[model samples]
Each structure stands twice: as structure tokens, then as C-alpha cells.
Target chain A: MPNRNRLHGEEGRAYWSMVLPAFSIYLLVMAFPIVLSIVLSVSNYSGGKMFGGEPWGFAGLKSYARVFSDPLFWNALKNNFYIVLLSVFGQLPLGFIFAYIIYRRLVKWPGFWQGVLYVPNIISVIVVGLLWQTIFSPNGPIAEVMNDLARAGFQSRLEALFASVGGFNVDDGLVSKILDMAGPAALDWFSDPVPELKELILSYEGAPLSELIGDLCNLFVPRWSPEFLSKPNIAMLPVLFVILWMYTGMYLILFLANMQKIDSQVIEAARIDGASEGQVMRYVILPALSGTIVNSAILAISGSLSSFSLIFAMTGGGPSRVTEILSIYMYNNAFLGRPNLPLANAISLVMVVISFILIGLTKMAEKRYGGKEE
Target chain B: MSDEIKTTALGRIGGAAAKAAAYAMMLLFTAMTLYPIFWLIMNSFKSTREFQVSQLAFPKEPTLSNYVEAWKMGDFGLLFPNSLIYTIGATVGIVFVSLLAGFAFAKIASRATKPIYNGFVIGILITAQSLMIPLFLEVNLLGIYNTRFAVLLVYIGTGLPIGVYLATEYIKAIPSALIESARIDGASFWRIFAKIIVPMSMPVAVTLSILNISNIWNEFALINILVSRTELKSLPLGIYKFSGSLSTDYGKQFAALTIGMVPMLLFYIVFRKQITRGVAAGAVKG
Candidate 1:
């Protein structure tokens, strides 16, 4: 009886040993923190104070209320939506196009192209942020090129109209006088006005030449002038540009990989049935890739919601809170704002819930469409 | 005959156009992708003053002085060895522990242990970001904070889930008949694992090692939180500090970034096929 009992115990011990390592890791890394986050969210736990020093007391729903009432929180939520929209609508499709072009062997040296495309993904976010900041800065190469283009456009349009009226020389003072009266600050094409105008054109939607003229008229003619960054409706444009530039490549790569996995035979069959490329794409390829698209879309949405590093590194959620996402606001609340730990935790918890809800919806859609094949 | 030939010619023209259009799109994206890295490398050779004034222009005369300055000031020579020690130590420990745990899960059948295994699966759901602060406190409490050992422990713990999952999947594919045969021959369990199991699972091990190396090399937040001592800093943290200290020096910062990325880049190049296969397999298994 003793030997039989000992053998059973050894067998039990062998079984437990297999699971102990995994259990220990889970306990330390996952289970502990999840419990701690809930506790911290309920109680007042500031980083400045030690575990015992602070009057460890619970504050009920006050933290949640504070987050809801804050204007910065609202702004951040809105900005997050903007990022999600841009990433899903803009980045996903573009990524598919790129991946499709490369994977179909339409492009020579696909590996080199893949390497080039993958470069941005590998680089640190800080580096990408800094690179973009320089590119979009007022004095950067992009701005310089924009200014030159604006000047050339203005010159050609003015010359064409003047010459059409009869034999009118552009070198004459007539055009100069007209421009001086109508142009911003009577500035030449190479000056600040041109760059600003270029930026406005790149960002805002309007009739191109007319918009330029209207902007110039406003600048020169007083009544039409609007603060560029503070024009109420247009302030979000710069922030949008920055967010789009940073995340587009990441989403693109993900979607492209998914698109590549759609079997070619299905597409070929559709094509042989006299279906157009658009129809084949819409019917066969899109249905097959729907799960991947939805998964990527969900990821993009969550990523946008939590986006901090790029926005923080680039804009610091600046130009009057126009670009602040929730994570940035949460960071501010914890570190820079009132050091309101309860409020920060409350906001973070809300953000976490929002992320889960978004992911949950995507999963539902994915199931409806048929789950991704492994 | 002429009409038939003309229709065929038109079809070829259409196909060629489509191909050309595709190539055009690829070229455009490739340029966009290469631009930033190209900019970083180009700017790394320029003086700070020059970089500020002309963001896109090539340096009048490129220099290696920035690389030298970054190498010495960052104390990269010393830091590289420290990083290597931490990464290799943590990776070996994680691989070994996870392999043992994974093997047992794959081979053993104990009805009472199902819940425990399920608990390990739950670890995958929790994001690393959420646990960082709590883990920092725990690391401090354990009295290993600021030491290489603390960072190593955190790295191993963080890497455990994926490693175990991969190992379990790989081990499951190995036929139980082999283990049974070894057992029939009177081989001990330890000998069977070492001689039969380990050799067959080398591909998975190599794949896991590469994945862990890439992850640990690029890891920043954990290193930042766990190691307050500058002397024990990993490459990411070291480069971040080096960048901040030399604020005006774009050249040095780029050089540092380039240096930090080199090991992973080289690893990826050397083991591209394995790495890609590992990622694809791991994604499915995960």
C-alpha cells in the first residue's frame, strides 16, 4: 500500500511540474497586474507617494465623473476617431494596392521592394516622428517645393490671362502692380505667403486657383483673413496629416499581407467568366480577405485610440489641444496635470473599455463573415 | 487574318498596360518607404547647423566623425557587451524553461491539470503595457531592481507565453511513437528528451532564439523602468539618453539609431527565411 501510494504521488508530481512554470509566469505578469490596475483605479495611488505613505482610501465613482467632465478628454476622444478613420479608410486600401502590386510579380525585384516598404516598420517611432516633423516644418524641403510650385502656377496663370487679352508682356510692371495689390504682403512667390498657401492647399478642399486667390485676397483685403491654425473648422487638418503619415505604412503592410493570401485561382476564375478586375476584386478577393481587413481595421482603431508616442513626439498634442488623443491626455493627467492619479486611472480604464468594445465588434463582424482560416 | 491579329495585339497591349500600372504603383510606394531611412542616413553625415539649414541636401563633405563621437560618448563598447549578456542570459533561461513546460503540456495527460494549462493560455490576452507599472513595483520588492538580473527576469517572464505556445505546437507535431520506442529500449525520460526530443526540435529552437533576440534588442520600456543605473542600461535606453544629451547633434542621434538597429538588421538578413517562417507559424499557433 505504501509503494502504490508513493507511485501515485510521483505521477501527480510529474503532472504539476509541467504546469508550474507556465503558472508562475501568468501569475507574475498577467494576473497580478490586472488585479492591481483595478485596485489602483478605485483607490488613490500616485507615483510620487510610496505604497504606505498615502492615505490608502477608496474614492468611488468620482474619478470616472472627473474624466467625463474634462474638455481635454473629449478632444482626445475626437482625435482618436480621426486617427481611426484615416488609418482604416486611407492606409488600409493603399497598403493593399502596394502588396497586390508586389505579390503578383508585377514589380521586378520584389524582395528589394519589400525591404524598402518594411523599413519604416522597423525604425523606432521616435525617428519616424522626427523625420516627419522636419519634412512638414515651415522651412523644410516639402514646404520649399510647395512654395516654388505656387509661384510657378501664379506666374503661368497670370501670363496666360494677360496674353489672352492681347499682346501683354509679363516682364512689364502691370502684372506686378496687380499682384502687389492682390497678393499677400505684396510678397514674391518665394516668400512665406506662398508656403502657407501651399500648406493650405495641401490640407483644405476648395477650388484650387480660386482658393489661392481667395486666401490671398483675404490676407491682403482684411475681411477674408482667418487664423490658419485657429480657423475653428480647419485646425484639425495639420494633426490629421501628421497622424496619417506615421501610421499609414504600418496598416498598409498588414492589409497587404492579408490581400496576398487570397488564392489567385478564385480571381482567375472570376476573370475568365468575363468579369472585370473591379468585379473580381469586389466579389472574390474582397470576400476572401474580409476577415483580414476587419482584423486590421480593428487593430488600426485600437492603435489609433492608444496612439501616444508619435503624437507626443511630434505635436505634443499641441495647437490648442487639437491633436490630443486619450493616451496623451492620460499621460498629462498622471504626470503633468494635477497628478490626479484617480482621474488618470479612470480615463485609462475608460480607454481600455473602449478598445475592448471596438475589438469585440470586429470579432462579431469577423464571425459573421466567417472566421479567418489559419 | 489581319483583324484576328489586330485583336490579339490589342489584348497584349491591354495586359502590358495593366502590368506597367502595377509597376508604377510599386515604384511609388518603394520610394516613399525608402525616403525616411535615406533621409536619416544622409542627415547623419551632416553637422547640426547644416541639417537645420538644409534638411534634404547632401552634406558638402560627408564625415565619419559623428559615428566616432557616438561610439565613445555613448560608451557603446561597454554597453554592447552588457546588452549581449542580458539578452543571451534571458533568452537561454526563457527557452529552457518554456521548452520543459511546453513538452510536458504536449506529452503529458493529467485531467486535474487542464485548468492550470488553461490559465497559462489566459496570459496571452493581457497586454504587456497594462502590467508594466505593477511589474516594476514587484521587481523593486524582489530587491533585484536596477540590476541586470531584474531586467533578465522581466524579459524571461514577458517572453514566456509566446515561447511556450510555440514550443508546445512544435512538440505536438513530433510523433509519440519515437518517445515510446525510446522508452521501450529502457531509456530514461531525461535521456529521451535530451537525445530524441531536443534534436528534432532544433528548428523551432533556432526560430524562437531569433524572435527573442529581435524582441529583447528592441525592447525599451522594460529596460527604462527596471534599470535606473546608467551603467546597466541596454542599447535602446542608452541610445535614447545619448539622443537627449546631444540634442542638437542629429548626426550622432542617427548614428546611434543606426547602430542600435544593426544587430537585428543583420540577424534578419542572415536568417530571413527562418524568421519569416517562424512568424507565420507562430502567428497561426498563437
Candidate 2:
């Protein structure tokens, strides 16, 4: 202890030698960038070598002002907010529920289920995002399903009309009537169903009630458009869905691992005391895991705010930046297009500020509720 | 008493129904998670004609032509090795450096130790997005931007905080008596670290390796920013580029995705237990 407490000479050098390599890289990679970003946020450094062609000048608040003023920036911020809300409210609760179910042995083969559930988390986010992207694409699974439904609806309606007319004759009036019934929103998509109808007329069987129901339901649902991916309002939904799919497993394991540490006797005692399953979860498990829940909320908020790769891979902030979260917005600004490095830095700084504020709020709430639970 | 019996009977029925619902929910989620990858794999083996006919259909006549085409077009031959080099290089680098630092931090007593340790932990809070722009500048300043070395350096750097945090906590749990005995043998610090501490910390090193390997393997954003060259880029970047350029070719795109994920999936299958356990252990500890 005496020898270890105070080192000198070669021993002191050894201590530093071990620590410096990792610490220095950390500074260069993480710490220095943070400071440099703050500085760059104020300066109008476009791109290329810093201060290369044009001298760097301070544009105090200009970059931030531009970001705040930009509608796309706000859209990106709003999307990021959706992601944060999804991660905190959607993924965490779902993950916690899954973890609880497995913990309580509510599902058979808990290990198998746990392993299967966690599969998405271990795969590359880009792969998951791309897989989902393809699934949502025009020729992908969703389009196929929707297209089938669209076809079925046309056939069923045509059949009903033909039965009313007492014939399978090719009537332009019947076709026009059906098209009118489909409404304007479906018009563009419903275009050119006549040839398909002619083909189906020769071999069409009577539609089942279930198929008719499905066809009816498809009318109310947003028609799957090939341009949906490029449409501003609808584009972010797929990215958000993929994010939920990809991350829930991490929190599941986090909760399950922490839950396992809660002595079995505690849960058993709760049950013995006539606490129903819901009561045990609400009273014992929830309060006991409140700390981990708060920690996970902090993780989710920061992670959501900073998430980049999946969105980058899936949407790349296209469709006029509707799907752009702050990270993607920052990346697109800094690296892509005109390369507004200062604006990117400004966006990043805003991200940092937002993360801190959210995390601080999470901590504050945790303290308040956690104190009450005690 | 009769009323109580009736309520208990209702409670039992409710509980059974709830259990059934939970099972159904788990099954649904499992399908949601696995079906896409399964569909991708199934579609990858189909002919372009067959895929266009029905994306949902099992490959009518399974073929490897798409795989061959994707392998050549996606530049997997180059990018696969590049990804391996970065993942392995960063993972090994993280393990060695963090082990050394963790040992020092745990065993040594110095005024500098606490602050240095805290600095690494503080790094856990700094998200990679905020650092991306400035790190791009820093990499350029260092003249290593668009190079594999930049990717390696940043990967190791971003990885260190969690690595060091986990290692320090794990190493601290190792008994001091072993270090004391080694010191009494007049062992130099290097010898002690190499001979005693390194051997003793194999568990944490394995966990560290697992965590870093998986993370670095999947990482894209940092590498995307750091290196623009196709040859220098990793699997995720390669797959991303392919998805955009090969958007029309469903077979080729699925083939490329399968290639991108297969190695990691294989790695997961081989080391499933350790990977899951190691991940849980790492997260819980951190």
C-alpha cells in the first residue's frame, strides 16, 4: 500500500505511459472536437482547409440564426423530437414490458424469445434501415400487399356491379361508376385498372367476405404511392418505424438484466401478499427499476438526439428534408451539398444544448418521483 | 366467503387470459423482428424475373447469380477486408490500450489518476454527432482525413471512453494482494502488467473485445465522414452506397445486404451466448 500510494521515477513514467495513449486519443477524437465545434459555430468556415483561401471571420449568432430561421431546420428538429419521444415513450415501455414478461416466465422459452428479440440490435443499423427501406419501397412487401388489396377492391366492386347488372359484359358505364366511387385520392393510383379488370374478368372468382372486408379497409388507409418515400409528410414514418425496431432490444436487455437482480423472493412475497400481476409490476417492479428507467430515458434522449447512421442510410434526409433529424441536418449541411460547416457546427451545438436540457429534465423528474417512491 | 371465491375464480381467468395475450404479443414481435431479414435472404436467392413477379414468394428457382453480381458490383471484395481491418484493428487497439490504462488507474496512486479517470467517464456523455463536424476538421488538420488511419484512430478514440470505464471498474475488483506479491518479487511495472495483470484481466478483455468488435463493425457515421474513398470505406458504407445505386435491382440489393450482414450474423450465431452475456454485462456495468 505504502509503495503503491506514491510512485516515483520509472514507476511514475509507467503510470503515464499506460494512461496517455487512450487519454490523448480521447482528447483528439472527442474533447478537442467539442471545443473546435463551439469555435467553428461562431466562425463562418465554409469547407476545405480551415482559413485556407478566405480568412476566417466571426459571424456571431448568424449560423444559429439561420438554423433557427430555416423551416427545414425546424422540420428536422421536430422529427428529432418525434424520435426522442418514440425512444423514450415507445421503445422503453415496450422493451420494459417484454423484459417483464420474460422475467415473470409469462412466455415459454424465455431465452429463445430474448435471443430472437435482440437479433435486430446486433445487426448493423444500416442493414436494418435498408431492409426496412426496401420493405417500404414501391416494389417491396408493403407495395405488393397494398397493390394486391387495390386489385382486390377493384375486382370485388366490379363483381358487385356486374351482379347488379346481371352480366359479365364489359361496360364503360360500370367502369366509370366504379372509378367515381374510388374518390379523387385514389384516382391517380386507380388509373389504368381497366386493362387489369379486363384480364380479371375472364378468370375472376367471387370475392370472399374477408377479401371484401380487406378491400374495403384498403380504401380508408392511405393508398401506397410510389412517391410516398419522396413525399414530405409520409417519408419520416418508415425511418421512425425502423428506429423503433432496431433499438428496442438494447433497452430490453438493460431492463431484463436489472430485473434479474431483484431477488425472486421479493416478487414471490408480493404475490403471496395478494398483489396481482399488474400490482406487482406497478408497485414493486416499477419502483425498484425506476433508477434504471431514468438512466435509460437519459440514454434514449441522447441517443435519439444524436442518431445518424440509420436515418442517413434509409432516407438521407431527402424529400426536401422532411425526414431530416438534427443529426442528418447537421451532416447534410456540413458534408453534403454546399458544405456549410458553420451551420453544421451550429446545428450540432444546438443538439448538445437540447440533449443537456432533456437529460437534466429527466434527472430532475427522476429525483422527484424517486424521492416519493422512497 | 362465496363472493371472495367468485372473485378469485375471475382473477385466475384474467391471469390466464393475460398470460395468453403476453405469449401472443411476444410471438408477434418475434415475427416482426425476424421476418424482414428472412424475406431479404429468401429474395436474395431469386432470379430477377422471379423477384419482380412476386417479392413475397419463396425463390422459385434459387440461384447464386445475384450474389455473384452483387459481389462484383458492391465492391465487397475490397470493403469486406477494409471493414475487418478497421473492426479488428480498433477492437484490438481498444483492448490493449484500455487494459493498460485500466490497470494503471486501478493499481497506481497519483493526483492525476482521478481526474484522468473521470475524463474518460465524462466522454461517455459526448455523442458522436456533436463531434462529427469538428472531428472532420481535426482529421483534416492532422492530414489523415479520407484515410483508413483516420477511421482506425477515431474508432479507437470514440471506443476508449466506454472501454476504459468498463475496464477500470472490472480491474478494480481484482485483489490487490496479487499486485503486492508481484511487486515483492521485484517485478517491474511492465512485467507485472504483461505477466500478472494482463493474464488476470482476460474476462474483461473478452468482454471489451466483444463490445468493441460489434460496435466498430456496425459503425458508419464516423467512417462515412472520415473517409470518402470507396476502397477505404467499410461494409455499412458500401452497403449504403449499393442501396442507392442499385435501387432498381432487387436481387442485387438483397444480395449486397445479405453479404453485408452475413459475417456479423455468423459471428453472432457462433458466439451467441457470450455476445448476449457480454452485452448485458457491459451495459449493466457501464
Candidate 3:
């Protein structure tokens, strides 16, 4: 018995020795930082200084208040939710469809298609962002194509107007109101710093705001509709489009892997039961893929919530602070907000809470669905 | 019999239609994914003047000068090595440390196993967004701020939970007989792990390494927040130089982005199997 106890003790010691490094690293990098963030969020930690200065006085709930009132923060959250909605509604179904097509041998080159589809996932996000920017830049190929397609009379007229007044700042309330009256497309009808735009904006000699608005909105706005990342709602469409493009392939690969796990005989049996292909998909395939679909949804939700690099690279959260997601918002506060580290910390804490809530909600949905399916 | 024959004909027609749709989707998705990348490479060869004049047209006279210019702008010759040091060093650390800990949790029947393993599991769910401010503070506190070591340490830390979890799950599948028999032969724990566990757990250790490498290689956020010095910049940050307000070098920007991308793209192409497996394995175990 004593020998056995000694052996057990030795085993315990060995286990501790092995586990110690991992636990220590996790504590330092993950746990400690999280605790520090929570503490800093509540404290009077001003600027980026968390240490080596005057002790920060405790400020209760003020940072939270700042996050609540910030319109940009709300906008960022709404944009993030938009991406989430797209991921769930747009990317997942499309991914699953691709998987079903490939895995079911409806296509001959399954492996080739798989490889081709996944190419986007490997490219650096900065590169991807640059690629799209190249495609849609002010003088990019798309805009040039659109320019060719547009009416020549309208283009020359807009150019002359822009040259006469210089480029207009739509930020002026009166100009914006007037542009709205003319129609959305009239707002940015045609402009990219050529002799025309440079002459227009730079040459402006303070004419009545209405004439500028009328000339700009009624003529130019509609012309630059494909100028992605130009306005908030418009910018979101492209950003969301890219998000869908990049991730659908990943989820497709995932769904394919999961589909491979389901026995072929089960699918064959459904087919033999006089089930149409659609019926087979609805009954057998959907149920089998549900777990993976749920898992993918979880990943998508968490991923969408934390999306930063791609959007940041593409838009820098701008063309008017429209593309700022929660992660980018927090980054701006922490790193770029200049001495606003406390508010950044608060924003990060809010981000974490939201992540947990969303993840929990998905798991609950899965549970409810799983129970019904069973 | 006549009704059955009619239904069969309809079924065949429907199947053919579905197959055609599948072919169309496959072509569309591939084009959607690859076309932009192809365009980036194509335009990298064009001069900015040529790009402006005929952006869609193939370059009449392709130039390597854009690459030379982009290389200088990004200082990528310096940044590539920095990225290598972080990714390789972190990959080694993650695989090694995870092997040790995962081995303990999987092989040892001790009371500490459940809680210690659970600790790593909890570690996986902590998002980097939440950790940004405090992690910045903590790295500074550790006095490793702005150094490559700071990035490396954080990479290993973030990579460990998933690494250990995967290794643990993979190791759990190995029958106790091999490990127990090794123990009964009076082998030391280190020898057993190094020889028996390491070789037997080869596939998973590999998966972990690849995943870690890809992650550390492509990582932008942590390094972006952590490092400020131009020389210490990783490959992803190299593209930022082309984005200045006065950035007029469009040809060079595309070329620089291509330079930044090509190495990773080559790695992915060469090890497509390993990478695909690595990603799927990680996702499955998650």
C-alpha cells in the first residue's frame, strides 16, 4: 500500500511538471490580460498608461457610458451585425450548396474544384483588400468601364460643371439636403482627381451652396454608384461581399469534411426509398449536416464579431466612419484614440460580453433544434 | 408501367438540369475566388501610366521595375525574415510545450488532469479583441514590448490551448497498452514521451505545427498593435507603406501586395494537403 501511494505521488508530480508550463503561459497571456482589461475598464486609467505613473483613480461606469453614447460605436456594431447576418444567411447556405454539389459527385473534378475554391482563404487579407481596391479604385478598371458605358453628354456636362465650381464637399448640410432632393446618384455623379475634380474642388470660389449641390447631385452622384466604399450603406455592400467571398469557401471545405463522415449507405437508402434528390437532401442530408452547420454558425458568429484586419485593410473604417466594426472601433480607441485607453478597454470588455451572449444564443438555438431533430 | 416510365423520364431531365446548374456554380465560384488575385498579378507587371490608360488591357510592355520599386517601398527584404523568426520559433514552442502537457493529460491518470485540461480549454475561447488593451499592458509590464520576442511569446500562448487540446484528443485515441507497456518496461517518462508518444502522435503534432505556422505567418493584429518600429514589421504590415495619403505608386502597390502574398501562396500550394488537413482537423476538434 505504501509503495502504491509512492507510485501515485510520483505520477502526480510528473503530471504537474508537464502541465505547469502550459498553465503558466495561459495565465500570463490570456487570463492576466483579461483581468487587467476588466480592471482598467472600470478604473480611471487614462491615456495608454496602465502602469509606472500616478495611481489611476477609480471611475465607476464612466467608460461604459462613453461606449453607450458613441454613435460610431453603435454604427460599428450595426455593421458587424450586418456581416453576421450575411454569414448566416448568405455564406452558409451557399457553402453548403457547393459542398453538396461537390461531395455528391455532381461535378467530375471534385478535388480540383475544392482546391480552386479555397485559393482565396490563403491570400493575405491586405493583399485581398488591395486587389479589390485596385478593381474599384477611383480610376480602377471597373470605374473606367462604367465611364465608357455612361452617357457622353452627361459626362461632359458634369465635367464642365465640376470644373466651373471645383469639387463640392457634400458634408455641408445644405449641399447634402439639396443632393438628397435631386436623387442619390446625383450626389457623386462624376469625380476623381483629374484636371476636372482638382479644378472643381480646388477652384471653388464660394458660390451659393444650392448651385454646387444642384450641379454635383443632379449630375455626378449616380455616375459613381460603383465607387464602392464611397458611402456608409454603399461601402458596407462591397465589404460584406468580400467577406462572403472569402469565408464561403472555408465553410464549404468544412461542410464537405463533415459530409464525408456521413455513411454513403444512409444516403443510398434514402434514394432507394423513392425519395427525390431534393427530398433526400431535406431529410437525410440536412439532419446529418445540422451539427456541422451549427458549429459553422458558431464560428461565423464569433468570426464576424471579431472581423478587423480585412475590413480595416479595405476601408480603414472610413469614407465617413461607416465601415467601423466593433473590433476596429476598439482598436481605434485603444491604439489610435490618443490617451483613450480606458475607453478602449471598456469597449473591448463590451465586445467580449457580446461575444459570449451571441455564442450562448447560438448554442441554445442548436440545443433547441437538436432536441426537435432527435 | 406506363406511369413509371413517364416518371423516370422526368427524373432524368431534372437530374440533367441539376448537373448543369452545378457546373455553372463551380465555374462561377472559382472565378469569383481566383479572378481578383489573377488581376493583381497581371497589373503588377503594368506601369502606372499603362494601368491608368488601359487598366483592363494586358500590358503591351510588361515591366519588372514595379517589383523593384515595391520591394524598396515595403522593405520586404527585411520584413520576411522577421516573420520567419516569429512563425518558426512559435511553431516549435507550441508543438513542444503542447506535446508535454497533452501527454500528461492523456497518459497520466492523476486527479489534476481534469482541471488542468479544462484550464487550457477555457484558454481557447478568449478572443484577442478583449485582450488587446491588457495584453498590450502586460507585454509592456513584462518589458518585452516592441520586440519580436513579445510577438513570439504571445503566439505560443494563444496557440497552446488549441494545440494542447488537439494533442490531448489525438493522444487519447492511442490505446493505454503501448504507453502502459512502455512504463512496465521501466522506461522513464521523458524517454517514453520523446520516443513512443512523439512518433505515434506524428500526424496531430504535424497538424498543430502547420496551423500554428499559418496563423503566425498571416497574423496582423497582434504584431500591428505590439510593434511600432519599421524594421520589426511583419510581412502583412509591409503593405501599409503603399497606403500613405500621397500614395501615387499604384503599380508598385499591386506589386508589393503580390510580393507579400506569393511566398504564403507558394507554401499553401506546395503543402495543400497538409494545410487542408490542418484546417479541417482544427475545425473538427473545435
Number of the top-ranking candidate, with lDDT as the measure: 2
Q: Which regions of candidate 1 are displaced past 4 Å?
A: A1-11, A47-55, A147-276, A301-308, A317-322, A351-372, B1-11, B72-79, B112-117, B120-122, B141-144, B185-192, B242-248, B278-286
Tell me chain A's TM-score in each of the predictions. 0.72, 0.79, 0.75
Model 3 lDDT per residue over B1-286, tens place: 1124225777778878989999999998888788778877898899988987777778899999999988877888899899899989999999988989999888877666777788776555557755777788888777788898888888899899889999998888888888878888987777888889899999998899888887788788778878889888899988866765524578898898889788888988888888887887787533
Ranking of models by TM-score: 2, 3, 1
List the pairs of residues colliding in candidate 2.
none
Q: Which tens-of-lDDT digit does each residue in B178-262 have in candidate 2?
A: 8889888899888989998889899889988988888889898888889888889898988887777677788888898898888
Fraction of the real A/B interface contacts present in each candidate?
0.27, 0.69, 0.54
Give me the iRMSD of candidate 2, please.
3.2
Please write out the lDDT profile of model 3 over residues A53-163, one tens digit for every residue. 777878999999999999999998898889879988999899899999988888888988988888788887777776776676777777877765554545455445545
Task: Report the lDDT tens digits of candidate 1 across residue range B161-255.
Answer: 77887887788899988877876798765676679878988888887887777667666756766887768987766676543346456778767
Listed per model in order, the count of residue pairs whose N, CA or C atoms clash below 3 Å is: 0, 0, 15
Which model is ahead, 2 or 3, in terms of TM-score?
Answer: 2
Q: After superposition, how far is residue A352 of candidate 1 from its true place, in Å?
A: 4.6
